[model samples]
Target chain A: MKVYAIYILNKAGGLIYQNDINPGLNKLSANDYLVLAGTIHGVHAIASKLKPTEFEPSSKPFGGEKEIPIESSATFSSSISVRDSTINNDVVNGRWNNPNTNNTGLRSIETDLFNVYVFQSLTGIKFILITSPNPIVHNVASLNLKINKGELNRQFDLAKEIFHNIYVTYSDYVMKDPFYSLEMPIKNNLFDSKIRELAK
Target chain B: MIYSFSIFDRHCNCIYNRRYIHDGPLLTQSKPSSVNLKNSIGDPLGVSITSLPPDNGSGDNFSPLGITTKSKESGSSSAINGPIPGYINKYNDSNASKLLFGIMYSLKNITAKLGDLASLFNTLKSFSTENFRVHFMESATGLKFVLATDNEVDNLQHILKELYTNYYLNHVVYNALSPVEFGTDANEHGKISNSDFINATDSFLTSLSVFK
Candidate 1:
């Protein structure tokens, strides 16, 4: 079965993730996905900035406490680009001091003849997966099945399974990460290795 | 009620100590005879409640110093603590209610999102995907759940707070294991043996206890 593309968008609709799985599907210009991610990123940033503060005048005596923390500039900025490939290789090679710390970027995408699956998280991370129209993705790992048509259902399931697997890996390596910036592109090579393992 | 040491009262066999205080020419007792015992580790010993019990006046049963005692013998060592025998107990007995409640509360939260938590801390917590999944096996009368991450204490604190406050008696206990060994580990009943589960239970309980 043929799987096509993967795209990850931050909660802001910015295209933080875009990758073709099959490599045969129509390819968007490299800059197009980046522009999409940037636009969404800008919109999300503005939305957060524009969020109205809830300040209700209370008749009750104040507890002598206020809610807002002084908004100083963030310590980490988007300009800081750490290569995922370097980090992952360093970790696998045992060169990095911290094993648990690293970026696990966006979810995987799968494509087949029919539809695509996009998995989302509560934190507004979007994982887009495209897969074959068959049901065989359900049992993607089953080998040497003599019947091809009978396995179609299994193919679809397998694709779903792959997405689920990818989702799990994403949450484990990426979402749970405290250091990872929100709405930023993920670049960890460990994720790449896991995906390749999943594909195999 | 200074339970400075000696906490495990699982059998409620805590021995009480009674001492005397000087009441100006007359002899009065010191603190109440309350025993401190611990079953759940990390829970705070309930407040030092050597409080005197209230007197039952025409049945009003209220006192300003604290709750009144019902003991007819006012000088009795055990009777000094309270109106009823509920002396130093956080509520009635030890505050196992709060500690176990916290654990159970956390368990509810941890179990509710078992699969979700599997990926985050599985490696540090020493569990795999298949082993973390919790599906009820009615026949074996057991359950399974994902292990929490030991990589960070903040996350464990979050889980513990939820459990201690929302604890309840649950017959089902969960264990974490590797995916490949999930079913094979369950010989016939689809659940880990009681002894195996005990080890896992001790692991979790000990973690929470120390964490507390």
Candidate 2:
């Protein structure tokens, strides 16, 4: 439940900010952090590509599908239908309930030592949090233990909430600054203090 | 549900592998209708779907014979080996196994180095991807047992221990014919091909509540 580090990757997959909030994990060199960020970015992209296609329902319908669209309206209905169709498709595809539509890519990587949660914003920026294992999983060094799914899910929700707060602070302290340039290293003291507060 | 189980020797060679294939749809929280489809089809073993026992629940309910009493309908293992389509049946000596071993080896070292510098036994227990979760356990002798299951399933440390003490020790280690260390030489890359060991493992795993 403890966050070890935080890495912010820009839209272009470059490391813009890195911070270590905890001391459990060994420290990495500055160059190593950049390499790690790039490796994670690459792995995330590759993992999304490795997503199984066979399980997904076909995007296009067969036979009468094209004919029904032609017979619908042909004028203003086309624009409305386009929007309606996507919603309908999302419902049919069972993606309407998904909380993270923008984050259809890699969500998390969990190891015995820690868990890495990737929160990709709609704008394509990524917030990666490396944290210790869930409390239930913390006693893995011992042989006998029970894993409660309810607790794990609650931790995951808490992580999302943390990201939401970080996103808000970023928008305020980093994005609102007139001197701040886009896609550059975040060096603002206010943002850093806010992040520290949130991490605590 | 458990998708596959693999064993890696001290030398990072995959000595044994088993992959299970099922026709049921992937068990993701997003799809409720597909779960209904799976229910209607019933389990291949035809065991009645029983609710999972709570933490510290009664142990007597589980039969001693291990005939899969609990149902894992809530969780599902996606397509076995998601990225690879044609490499289902190939086991042990495959590129996939080698790559898996390599990942585990490097990650184990990283975890060990990152943890307390004074302690030497800070090995990695498990890791998970978007699709499946791998549960790992290492023996004092350095034998690694890796079990890949659905994401919903949690800590299988006890299961791995059971496999090591009950099955592996009896079938492989105690048996005189099997080699002590696997893949020690160029020609004798020992694979755990013992029929007795395989049958025992199959029954043991099939009897688990998680196996579907």
Candidate 3:
């Protein structure tokens, strides 16, 4: 999904990065950002279990959940095995060549105020990207919607592709630069340029 | 005395035996090397190891197998011929030879195994020096290799000195013979005998000797 906002939580549940690219969302104090990321992660996890799930379909053995999978719901096809647990479902079902992971955690939340995308690296470092949702994202369809609507969900694929590009750009520019420290704000010239291009 | 001779088809003890430089270290006496004699018919990949005398600090008058002495002078690329370093950032002839040596470690033995490299061997001769230049005569191609270095040495002893000066060299070499390999009878003199170097390098299986 095109990430509207990003939040990074340390393995110990400390928020590492929180940013709002769009103008609509309200900004938070640095400390409050941490508390918000941690609380939301815990709360979303609990809420997923409580969210009403649909009965399994008789025709398709895999589609046992409700008519629509919650945005955070991750599926692992029995075919692939992911040795690394850090990668999110959005990344795996999306583009990774390695085996699929059964578990996909809360990568983001799209609310009226802001959108958040969470990325956890192999070393337990989290990256959160927060951006203002396009006021125009009213009818954007996601990956599963292709299977459900049979209408060819091009917009959802485009959005996920955008996230993939952004993720790779962040990894190359921010993560690899020796000067940048963990959980710190990225100020790389390349990152700034690419983000601006994608923001457009 | 260093003239080359075709050793194939020579008889054992057909000629007079005299005190040679390498007799002490080599296993066979007045005989063709055990391994060379085997490959006399034909063994293309034959290789052996021979023991070389310890380093005496001289750069010229030295063997490729010798290690750097206590002076701990570090080597640099393209610095082989001159005191000044040349820009050979990529590995050239010097490094290519090093890589061949590395490959030899893995593939030589399985290809061909010869006993001794020479029927007679000569211990490596060395002289010590702190100067930039070293004088060397190659055995394989009979070429001379010299190098100039930057390190300075003040005492100016014999090991690194010129060959013509009688007292210039601090040490002399005998042959490939070591007491542990040939037994105590081989250790009669501190120096190696000529027969040793001949035998050490005689066989295609040259690396078999400790000299390698």
Give me the candidate number with maximum lDDT: 2
Q: After superposition, how far is residue B211 of candidate 1 from its true place, in Å?
A: 60
Choose 2 or 3, whichever is better by TM-score. 2
Candidates 1 and 3 compared: the better one by DockQ is: 1
lDDT of 3 by residue, B101-140 (tens): 2222211221111112332111111111111111111122
lDDT of 2 by residue, B1-212 (tens): 67778888888877887766433422111111222333322232222223222221211121110111112223332222342211132356644466466556655655564553456463566655445556777888788998876566766777888899989999999999888888776454467877787778887776777775
lDDT (C-alpha, whole model) for all candidates: 0.32, 0.59, 0.30
Worst 10 residues of 1 chain B by lDDT: B130-139
- Cα lDDT tens digits, model 2, A108-156, are 6555567777777656688988788775655655444344333444566
Q: Please give the lDDT score at residue A162 for candidate 2.
A: 81
Could you give candidate 1's per-residue lDDT for residues A1-200 as a string of tens digits?
55555667777676765556555443446675565444333322322221111112223332333222111112122112233445777778765321111011211211122343334444546655554444443223323222122232244345556666777777777767777776687776676666656655
Ranking by lDDT: 2, 1, 3
**Residue B210 error, candidate 2, Å:** 1.7
- Report the number of the highest-DockQ candidate: 2
Q: Tell me the tens digit of each residue's lDDT in model 3 across A91-158.
A: 75765632312123333332333344444445455555544433443233322121112111233234
lDDT of 1 by residue, B77-111 (tens): 43333222222222222232222222222323322
Name the runs in model 3 displaced over 4 angstroms. Answer: A1-5, A44-102, A117-156, A181-190, B1-212
